[model samples]
Every structure is written in C-alpha cells, then in structure tokens.
Target: MPTDIAFYTNPMSRGQIARWMLEEVGQPYDMTILDYDGTMKAADYLAINPMGKVPAIVHKGKVVTEAAAICAYLADAFPDAGLAPPVDQRADYYRWLFFAAGPVEAAVSNKSLGLTVPEGRERSMGYGSYDQTVTTLEKAVSGGQWICGDQFTAADVYVGSQVDWGLTFGTIDSRPAFEAYAARLRERPAYKRQKELDGALIAQMQKSS
Candidate 1:
C-alpha cells in the first residue's frame, strides 16, 4: 500500500515548493488548506509544528516542517521519482538545498524587512550580505542546466522556488544566471501543474472570502 501523506499548507506561502515537489514525486497526497490566522494556529496544527508554520506535512505518521525539509523528505520517500541522488552522490544536493533554506531565506527576508547587516557585522550573519548571497546563488545555479549539474532533483525544487519568488517580489536581484535557471525550472510540467492548482485554490479562497 502507498504511504499515507497529508499535506497541510496555505496556497500563498512557501508551501508551493512542497506542492511542486509532491507533483514531481508522482504520489497521491491529501491536501488540507490551513488559514494564516485560523486553522494554522489551532491546537491540532500546533501539535505538528509548534511554530504554527504554513508548510508542514505528515507522512506515514511522521511530521515534517519547513519547505525544504518537506521537499527532501518527499524525494527520499518516493525514490521512484528520481528526485534525489544516491547517498554517496549527495554532496551537491545537500549543499545547495540547505544553502537555499538558510542563507537565501535569511537574505531575502532580512532585505525585505529593510534590515541589513553592517559591514563590520558581516561575519556575524550567516548570509554575510544579500549581494554576496545572490551572487553566490547565481554562480551555483549557473553552473549547469540544474543546481546539481545535469539533474533536476529536489534541490532545484527548493532552491529554484526561492530564486523565482525572490525575483518576483524584489527580494533578490534579477541576475542573468538566476533568471535563466528559474526559467528552466518553470518549464517543467510538474511546476506548471502545481502553479495551476495553487492558483485555482487561491482564487477560490478569494472568492469565498
């Protein structure tokens, strides 16, 4: 029997990354849409994630929070999707995947909040500076057709989503390399399908509200 997967997320958050990864995994998952100020903070949801985050998942009775973690988990859980490299060949995968979640997330969020680390405090911050983080990501994704070089693994799903959303929201600079890489990821069928589904869900929610 297929493992039971329950995806708890909102349509407007980083949950889209997990949804796209789920599509790539080719697994049937039941989605429970949670509101930002409503069900997301309820006791039942808080049990899965104390932080009351929007993108969390329950798979086979195990809960996974954070968008990158959910994507990584789905890739490993459905190895048939080929969304992951073998354990011994996961150096690039782990590096960029976690880098996107850490530095990329920090840089974008901090910049959007009009917060910047002073030059003297660059060493204290994990992302150094937004420019440094963006340039490094540009080089990383520009290395080849994909983040892992020649494979469209879960790394692309996580990292590419960050780049794409950053560019859209003016959080990250629109570097040529980032634009190109994001383009490649957007052309995937799974990404397109995930966008369509989430777009519809958002429209429905808007209409009801």
Candidate 2:
C-alpha cells in the first residue's frame, strides 16, 4: 500500500526544494503550511520534528525530517520514478547526494553570510573554500549534462537544487557550465510544473498579506 504523506512546510523556506522532489516523484501529499509566529514550533509539529524545521514528512506513521532525507526517501518509495540508481549504484548516489547537502550547502551558506575559513584552516575545511568548491562542481557538471551522467536521477534534483538556489541568490558564481546545467534542469516538465504551482501560491499569499 502506498503510504499517506503529510508534508509540513513553509513555502518561503527550503521546503520548496522538497516540494520539487515530491513533484518529480509524482507522489500525492497533504501539505500543512506553517506561519512565522513560531507555529512550526508548536507541540504537535515539534513531536513530528523537534528541530521545528520545514520539509518534514510523516509517512506510514514514521516521520522523516531534513530536506535531503525526504527527497531520498520519496525516490526509494516510488521506484517507478527511477530517481535513484540500483543497489550497485548506491555508493555513487550517496556520495554525490551527501556532497551536495554538506559541502555545497556549507559553502553557499558561508558565502551568503560573508564568512570565510580561517587562513590556517583552509586545508582542513570540508569545502576547502567557496571558489574551490565551485570549481569542483563546475568540473563535475562539465563532465556530462547531468551530475551522475547522461541520465537524470534524484541526484540531479538534490544537486541541481543547490546549484539553482546558489545561482539565484548569487552565492555561487555563474560559470557557463553551471548556467547550462541549470537551463537543462529548468526545461524539465516536472520542474516547470512545480515552479508554476509555487509561483501561484506565492502570489496568492502576497495578495492575502
């Protein structure tokens, strides 16, 4: 049986990324949009996720938190989507996924905040430096049209979201490779549909405000 999913979110947050993943998987979900007055921190939601974060999902009576985790879970649950690779490809899948979540996120966050690694600790930094991370990502995307290869997998959803958000906020440089990669991702029907839905929701929210 397919599990019923409850997606707790705030559209303005990273929850948008999870929304995109859900659309990619073509899963039906019930959404509860949280407001800024600490509503997400309420006792009930906190029971679902103590961290009071958006992008949490309750499926089959089990709660899954964190954006990346939710994306990965949905891919597994909906095998028909083929967002994930086979067991033999699991190693590469986990590698690139975590690489996007950890180092890529850290670099983007730090860059947005104007933070820099200490001069002596540069070598010890997980992401090395923003420029180095961007260069590494450029090479990865430059190797093929997508992150993993010619195929578009869930890895692209995760990593592509990072690259898309980074470019949108100017946190990451817009090299030609990155630009081309983002263009290809945007051309996907799933991505376009999700963006349109999100845009309408945003407009409605603004009108109500």
In order, candidate lDDTs are 0.90, 0.85
RMSD to true structure for each model, in Å: 1.4, 1.9
Reference-based TM-score, model 2:
0.94
After superposing candidate 1, which stretches have Cα over 4 Å from the reference? 1-3
Give the best candidate by lDDT. Answer: 1
lDDT of 2 by residue, 82-133 (tens): 8987878676678778888888899889989989998778788899988888
The Cα error of candidate 2 at residue 99, in Å, is 0.7
The positional error of residue 136 in candidate 1, measured at the CA in angstroms, is 0.5
* Candidate 1 lDDT by residue in tens digits, 52-170: 98798899899999999998998888898999988999998999999999998999899999998987999999999998998888877988898777888999999999999988888
Instruction: List the candidates' TM-scores in order.
Output: 0.97, 0.94
Query: Which residue runs of candidate 2 sit more than 4 Å off their true CA positions?
Result: 1-3
Which candidate tops TM-score? 1
TM-score of 1: 0.97
